[model samples]
Target chain A: MGQRIQSLRAGALDVAPILLGVVPFGLIYGVAATEAGLGSLSAFLMSSIVFAGAAQLVIVDLLAQNAAWPVILVTALVINLRMAMYGASLAPHFAHWSPWWKRVGAYLVTDQAFAVSIIRYEKPMAELPKRWYYFGAAVALWLVWQCSTMTGIALGATIPASWELDFAVPLTFMALLVPSIKDRNSMLAALGAGVAAALTSTMIFKLGIITSALIGVLVGYFAEGSER
Target chain B: MIASQSTGVWLLLGAVGVGTYLIRYSFIGILGRAEVSERVQRLLRYVPPAALAALVVPGLLFRGDNPGLTIHNYRLLAGLLAATVAWKTRSILATIATGMSALWLLQWLF
Candidate 1:
C-alpha cells in the first residue's frame, strides 16, 4: 500500500513540469477546434476521446481546410504512429500487469508521461509500482487536457504568444533528455536526432520527427561503443 | 434530413478515436506476450533519448517558417540555460523554475 502511494506520487510529481507545457497547447487546440467549425461539445469530446495533442490539432486544422475526411483520418493516424513505438518501448515495464491494465497503460502513453516514466523505469527497481505511477501521470494529464481545452473553447485561445508557453514543452524534454545521455552511443544518438529533426521539419504531415527519431535509434544501435 | 457539417466532424472524431486507440494498443498488447531478443532490447533502449531529442531540438531552434539559429530567438538562449541546469542539478523542479524565469526575463527585455 505504501509503495503504491509512493509510486503514484512520484509519477504525478514528475509529470507536473510537463503539464505546464500542455496547458498552452491544449488551449491552442481548443480554440482551433471550435474555429474549425466543430461544435464545442464535439471538440471537448475529442479531447476526452482522441486524447493525443498533435493528432487532435491536425484533425481540426485539416477540417478547417475542408480536406476530405479520409485524408484527415489517415494523417492523424500517421502522426500517431510514434505511439506504436512508445507501446513497444513501454511493454517491458508493463508486461506484468493484467491485460486490461496494459491496454489502459497504452492509452496513457503520451510523450511526456512516457519520457518521464521510462527514464525512471530504466533504473534499478525501487519499491514503487509502475502501474500506480503511470495512473497518477495519466490522471494529472487527463484533467489538465480537458480543462485547458475547455478554457480555450470558452475563451478563444487567449494565451498570448509573448508568454511563450510552447517553450515549456521542449524545455521539459530538454530536462528529461540530458540524463539519458551517458556515453558515446547515447551522445551520438542525441546529436544525430537533433540535427535530423531540425533539417527535416519541412516534411509534410509532420513526419520529420518520427523519421529522424528512427534514424537516431539506428545510429545508436549500430554505433561502435558498447561499454555500458 | 440535414447533412450537417458537425455530423462529418463527429464522424472524423469517432473514427480517429478508434484508430488511435488501436494504434497505441498494438505493440503493448502484442509485445508483452513474448520476450524480445537482446538485439530488440538494445534498440528499445535508445528510443527514449532519440525520441526526446527529436522532439526538443526543432522546437528550440526553429520557428514557423524560418530557422532561429541567430541570437534573436530568445527561446533557444533560454533553453541552453535550462539544459545546463538540468545537467547540473538533475532536478525537474530546478530546471523548470530556473529555465522559465530566464525565458520570461529574456522575452521581457529584448
Candidate 2:
C-alpha cells in the first residue's frame, strides 16, 4: 500500500508541470463554451463528461456554429480515435488489474496521462504497480481541468484571441513526438505521418489524423521488413 | 433544460460522451486478456510516433482554415525551431517556450 501511494505520487508529480500548460487551454475552453451559448452547468458538464481538451473544444466550436449533430459526433470521435491506440499500447502494463478497474482506467486515459504512464511502464521494472501512477496523472489532470474550465466560464470571453493559445497543443505534441522517433523505421513513420497529415488535412470530417497515423504505422512496419 | 441547451444539444452530449468512453475502453478492456501476436505488437508500439506526428504537423501547418505554408506562417517556422530544440535538448519546457516566443516575436515583427 505504501508503494502504491508512492507510485501514485510519482505519477502525479511527473504530470504536474504538464498540467500547467493544460490550464490555460482549459480556461480558454470555459470561455469558448460560454460564448457558444452553453450555460455554466452544461459547460461544466462538458468538461467533466468529455474530459477531453481538444474534443471538448471542437464540440463547443461546432455548437457555436450550430453544425449538424452527426457532424459534431463524427468529428469528435475521429479526434478521439487515438485514444484507442493509447489504450492498446498501455494494455500490457495493466494486464494484472481486474476488468472493472480497467474500465475505470480507460476513462482517465488522456494523452498526457498515457504519455507519462507508458514511459514509466515501458521501463523493465518488475511488479511496480503502475496503475496507481496512471491514476495519479489522470486524476490530477481531471481536477485541474474542471477547476480551470469553471474559472474560465466564470470569467467569460475575457481571454483574448490574440494570445493564439491554441498553438500550445501542437507545441506540446511536437515535444512529445521528437523523443518517440528513436529509430530509422520510426523516423520514416514520423515523416510519412507529417506529410500525409498535411496533404490530407482537407479531407472531410477531419479524417486526416487517423489516415496519416495508419499510413505511418504501415510505413514503419514495412520499412522494418525491408531492412531485414 | 440543462443549461438552456436544446434537447438536441443534450443528445449530442450523451452520444459523444458514450461514444468517447467506448473508444477509450475498447482495447484496454480486451487486449490484455487476449493473446497478442508480435506483428500486431510492433504496430501498437509505433502508435506514439505516428499519432503524435499526425497531430503536430497539421496544427502547425494550418491557421484555422487557411494553409499557412508560406514563410509568413509564423507557426510553421516556430514549430520547426521547436522541433530542433526538442531534438537537441529533449526538453518540453524549452520547446514550448521557444516555439511560443518565436511565434509571438515574428507576429509582432511582421
Candidate 3:
C-alpha cells in the first residue's frame, strides 16, 4: 500500500509541469475552435471526444469551412495515425495490467503524456507500479486540457483574432519536435515528409496532407531500415 | 432538426476512428507476443519526425492556393528561423518569441 501511495505521489509530481505547459495550448485551441466557427459546446465536445490537439485543429478547420464530412473524417484519422504508434509502443509496458486498466490508459494516451511516461518507465527501477504513473500523468494532462480549453472558450468570443493566436499551436509543436531530432534516419523522415506535404498538398484537393504523412511514415521506416 | 451533420459523415467518422484504432492497437492485440524482425523495428523508429514534418510543412509554406515565395511570406521564413534557433538553443520561450515576432513583424510590414 505504501509503495502504491508513493508511486501515485511521484507520478503526480512528474506530470505537474507537463500539465502546466499544456495550459496555453489548450486555451489557444479554444480560441481557434471558436474562431473557426465551432460553438463553445462543440469545442468542448471535440476536445473531449477527439482528445488530441492536431486532430481537433484539422477537424475544426474543416468544420469552419463547411468542407465535406468525408474529407474531415479522413483528415482527422490521418493526423491521428501517430497515436496508433504511441499505443503500440506502450502496450508492452502495460501488458500485465487488466483489460479495463489497459483501455483506460489507452484513452489517456497523448503525445505529451506518452512521451513523459515512456521516458520514466524506461529507467531501471524496482516495482514502481507503472500503471499508477501513467494514470497520474494522464489525469493531470486531461484536467489541464479541459480547464484550459474552457478558459479559451470563455475568452474565445472576446479575444480578437488579430493576435494570430492560432499560429502558436503549430509553433508549440515545432518547439517540441526540435529536441527529438537526433539522427540521420529521423532527419530524412522529417525531410521526406516536409517535401511530400509541400508537393502533394498542391497537387490535388484532398488527402494531400494525409497521403504525405502516410508516405512520410513509410519513407522514414524504410530509411531507418536501409541504415540498419 | 438540430441541423446535425449527415449520417454519411457520421459513418465516415466512425470508420476513420475504427481504422485509427486498428493501426494503434495492432501491436498490442495481434503482435503482442510475436517479435518484430530487427529490420522492421529499426524502420519504425523514423516514423515520428517524418510524420510531423509532413503535417507542418504544408501549413507553413502554401497559403491557400498559391506558393508565395516573396519576403511577404515572412512567417514561413520566421518559422524556419525559429525552428533553427530551437534546434540550437532548445529554448521554448526563445522559439515562441522569435516565431511570433516574425509573424507579427511580417504582418505589420505587409
Point to the candidate with the largest DockQ. 2
| Residue runs of model 2 more than 4 Å from their true location after superposition | A1-11, A14-43, A54-99, A111-134, A152-156, B1-13, B64-67, B89-93
Better candidate number, 2 or 3, judged by DockQ: 2
TM-score leader: 3
lDDT (tens digit, per residue) of candidate 3 on B17-99? 56655655566555664665655555556555665676567657764533455555665877888898789877655677788
Winner by lDDT between candidate 2 and candidate 1: 2
RMSD (Å) per prediction: 6.2, 4.4, 3.3
TM-score of each: 0.63, 0.74, 0.85
Clashing residue pairs, backbone N/CA/C < 3 A, model 1: none
Model 1 misses residue B42 by how many Å? 2.6
Better of 1 and 3 by DockQ: 3
DockQ score for model 1: 0.41
Assess candidate 1 and give its lDDT. Answer: 0.75
lDDT of 2 by residue, A1-228 (tens): 888898889899999988877776777678777767787787888887888887787677656655557867876776676687788787878778888888899899998899888888877655556778888899998999999989988977565667775676677678778988999999998899889999987776666667888898888988888987
lDDT, each prediction? 0.75, 0.80, 0.69
Considering TM-score, which of the candidate structures 2 and 3 is the better prediction for this target? 3
Order of candidates by DockQ, top first?
Answer: 2, 3, 1
